[model samples]
Target: MTLPAPARFGIMTAPSQVDYADLLRVWREADTVPGIEHAWLFDHLLPIYGDPRGVTYEGWTLLAALAAHTRRLRLGVMVTSNRFRPPAVLAKIAATVDVVSGGRLDFGIGAGSRPDVPMARREYEAHGLPYHDGAHAVSALAEACAVIRRLWTEPEPFDFTGEHIRLAGAFGNPKPVQRPHPPVLVGGRASATLRVAAEHADVWNYPGDDVADAVRRGALLDRHCADLGRDPASITRSLVLPVSYDDPAPVRETIRRATAAGFRHLVLMLPAPYPEGVARWLADEIIGERPV
Candidate 1:
């Protein structure tokens, strides 16, 4: 199996407190960075930290808008929750965005994990979305992935019966601009999640700042791929590291360690209240120095 090219960099920004105009400005500026390959938004109904009641923009809606506004940078959520939308509907949304962006969409998804805050839980309950945990959640995520792939690739209407999702006469129209659909990036390190990534993902993304943890998860993913008779190299290895604009040294070191750990794609999560010119500075100082 041939490994694809390496050293692609992305920035994952949370849509917290930023208005439409400001968000568009950030995206436009990030797009000008020479080595920045993609820009992503976090998928969260509420802020991950601080005041949970703070304003947070919807990821898919922002992505569609970004697709129209930017030309160079690939766009997607860092990982969208499977519970937020039906699998078929998610597929259609992704396909439409791919078309709008001229085939520049990376469909990142993950099993819905329970948030630590009560407000978040209330938000889920308010929307009547079940927030399952353990094996049930993993199975749902895996089934969602299967359903999405079928919707993108299968032409004839077909019934999909899975442990969690059941679809009748499902047909996805206006197939994605990207052949076989845009890259399905599965995020998580759980055994079941890795198994699903091995079977369905074009990319496997692990979060956190620890390089050792990333290495361990990558090895586990490789084992799962091997067990399933899949080429480990076929799935792009990616890591998402939260960055401190004030301290660039550690971020640089994290990039070095992630590269050594065999991650070809590195996504930096810029902290809230993103400083002016920081994205460009990182692109020029860190990502641009690496070979693509």
Candidate 2:
């Protein structure tokens, strides 16, 4: 199937269970490939899979290093966890990356790990961070999103007193290179999150393989947008799917289904121990002549 207009193709190299050299290699290769328009890293304080003690590089730090090394690929953490750091501080980190990359920054964020998911839940406890209920999380996420935008664009020092977040004379210097701030990409599937996306996101990503589910969640987002008197089309739909090294057929089929479902931002997830020239191989095989 032909990709729709304004479609994009990018790679996500989850920044865990791998070394910096390996990630840099794939990103540098992707930098020169036109089919690959963006690159991503994931935020996790500990390895969520395999051994808990496996090597895991911090997302923003690694992103900064990778940004300095690569020349072209638009880059960011796939979806930064709002619970991991205060929103204002995160804004600063993201802006610095935008400067480092010469404005090639996509700010992706989410409401952090779900308390119901044990794998994600343990990361919070293990790191001595508080784990809040879903209600609290969703509300705080909204506030954090607002705070982040203010930190990125407000001209002078300001204060905020949201129920979940409070600030005093907060301000940002050396603002992001993107005039209004880098494009905000919010990732989540819940109805509450979709509402936040309707109000704040330039892109909304569904991180699963369920095409039917994506369509359903997308409809929910459309309703949310309508309720807010906003255009649903304003938020670009994104899908995050894993890449099969030995078989591109299944991935290709998923891509077709997702595009037909109105998802244009495809984030092809690459597993660890990346092979030589995998980026070029992706261009020739999976993304061949897609007009992205």
lDDT of each: 0.84, 0.90
Tens digits of lDDT, candidate 1, 1-292? 8654778998988888677777787788888887898989978777767676778898998899998999999889889988789888998998899989999999999886556556556667766777776678778888888888888999899998878888999999888998878898999888888998999899999866678987888889999999999999899998887777667788888888778778888898877676677668777766767643
- Lowest lDDT sum, 10 consecutive residues, model 2, at 1-10
Give the best candidate by TM-score: 2
Give each model a TM-score. Answer: 0.94, 0.97
Error of 2 at 196 (Å): 0.7
Clashes of each: 0, 0
| lDDT by residue (tens digit), candidate 2, 101-197 | 9999999999888777777788888889998887788898899999989999999999899898889999998899998999999999998888889
RMSD of each: 2.0, 1.9
